[model samples]
Target: MATRIAPHEMPMIGRRELVCLIALMMSLSAMAIDGMLPALDEMARELGAANGNQRQLVVAVFLLANGVGTLFPGSLADRYGRRPVLLGTLAAFAACSIAVALVHSFEALLVIRALQGFSAAGLMVVPYAIIRDQFEGDAMARLMSLVGAVFIVVPVVAPSIGQGVLLIAGWRWIFLSLAGVSAIGALWLWLRLPETLHPEYRHEINVPIILRNMGAAFFNRAAVGYVLGTSLLIGAVFGYVNSAQQLIGEHFGAGTWFPVVFGATAAMMVLSNIVNSRIVETFGARRVSHAGVLLFMLVSMVQVWASYAHPGELAWFLPLMAANLGLLGFLGANFGSIAMQPFAHIAGAASSIQSFFRMFGAAVVGLVIGQAYDGTARPFAFALLICSVLALALVLFSEKGRLFRRLNGPVRQEAE
Candidate 1:
């Protein structure tokens, strides 16, 4: 008999190939935010955004747009092909990046920024949808983990990269850099990436069908619950991203070193990703993610107390931020996988709807929490705590109160 090779055993990606590809796709989304960090102050000054905190609206709006974008691109990828949709979105994103860089007024920037976000929606969801298309089971988890590890490096290094550009050129160049990067990504995809959606399995896109699929995803008890929970998690993360600069720059008086501390905190996410990748197969995503949420909740409470107790110390603040972000790496990938697992049949529509809700939810949270910014870390801490509690509640309800039953063994059943 001929020997049969397992899917995982097949040598598909060359060395660093997977990481580079994953990083490239992930960077499309991360650069949208990371590259803008250093430019925030300059942009605010140039555009005359009202308050220092109000500048964060640029980041929040983009995230919300990303959520909205995620909804449709998935279906388009499923219908037409992943390559064309991704390439189209990247070109759109590049155009918006240039627009953001050139715009002179705050109002104009807001509109352009939102469009940039809308463009990003395709970038954020399609990459994962592509991965899910190629791999599943333990292979899916491992690839996701590697992708998560590479994904986090953007946040770790992007701030410094942005700051470096700020030192040489003006803030406008930051957007230009993003535009250039997007163009490169588009070119790369055009050359190397192939269509992952098989013709036999592809669905025809229709208005009523999309609506029905979206409605089904929303009504699915497990899917809806996980989506809501994931939204809260994203909201908490957006709240932090919106306020991180202010907390580090104004509150801690870190000045130019703001990006350094921010990068450090972001780097901790890599640690969590490593842990998640190593254990997810052994422990299962459900067990790992459930524990991560509980851990996140506890850490948030501690952060709230610490921020209140010692209002002006980096020693107290950095550790708390690191721990909080580290746990998020574990929570993010697993939650997304678990949520999409039940909707594999309509992964495109499901991804779009879920992503839209998550991003839009984050925007609302970012806006509200950002308003509470008072030149202190207190608001960030409190917002995280509240969001964590809500996420925990949703996860519990989604699991039908059996959240921890999978901790000791493989989660043999679907989330419901």
Candidate 2:
């Protein structure tokens, strides 16, 4: 079957170009999320947010809408092909960004943000399918790690970029700037990215065919729980994004350095992805990711302690939060590669469904944690601990209580 083709069995793109292009494409969603973070306060003040927490809803509403939108694009990509859906969404995303800049009220801003998020969802879904069309197992995991390493650069600099824009102009310019960035990405894809949908697997846009594909993707033992588990694990990361300005600025006293501080924490993720890319094939995704989940729980426990012990001390809180995020970087690529290993035939449909649950569920989890903030790190720390523990349980269930054993040997690399 085409799904079981050997690694690099099909046509190839220039490895370096492919990696960089995919990274740039994936970074659009990250930029959309992290770029506006610096603008939250300005947006709240101008739009008349009821309270500080209301600002978080900007991120929350976008995420929730992005999650909802994940349900369609993959299936559509499977039927219509990746290139068209991707270009269309990029255009739509850019249009929405402009709309967001022109909006005058908090409600209008959220409505535009939600629309932009749906476009972002399309951007998020198609790439995995594109990757799966050519790779699987440890090869896919390694490539994902590489893509993540490059992709994470956006989050690290996005806040700084947003802050820079805010310094010279109003928050609306941040949206406009990202809209410009999206245009560049769209043009790049149009000129270079080829359609990756395998001819044998061009899913017809129909109810029964879609259901069958969905069933195969969702019911598989290897994929479903891991997808859910990943959703649970990532909730804290999103939670952190939601409350970052409040936590780093107001509670920890970073003040005007909040963007710099946020960038520093995100920088840890880059290092983690680099390390994961290096060792994932050697140690195996299960062993590495399982260990990561355990470490995340342990780190969460310590983070909770430091939160209460030092209270408002940035010194104590920042490093611990950074460590947990670093551990998350280790888990993110591996978990996705694992869940995606079994569904190459239905990669588009599967990626969309998994992404839906991952984003929507994490958004809900983030909403809870973000809303529970009370000017202290304890609640956030505790939520992280809870999410880690629950994620471990789900991974354990996915493995039927098995842990630390490699199931599939990764294929040899071809210098890609």
Please name the candidate that would achieve the greatest lDDT relative to the true structure: 2
- How would you encode candidate 1's per-residue C-alpha lDDT over 16-96 as one tens digit per residue? 575577578768778889877877998899889998878988887888777767778978987887788888898899999
Give per-model TM-scores.
0.92, 0.95
Cα lDDT of model 2 by residue, 312-334, tens digit: 99988878888988998889899
Q: Which ten-residue region of model 1 has the weakest summed lDDT?
A: 1-10
Residue pairs that clash (backbone atoms under 3 angstroms), model 1: 67-356, 70-352, 71-352
Give the CA lDDT, 0 to 100, for residue 34 in model 2: 96
Residue pairs with clashing backbones, model 2:
none
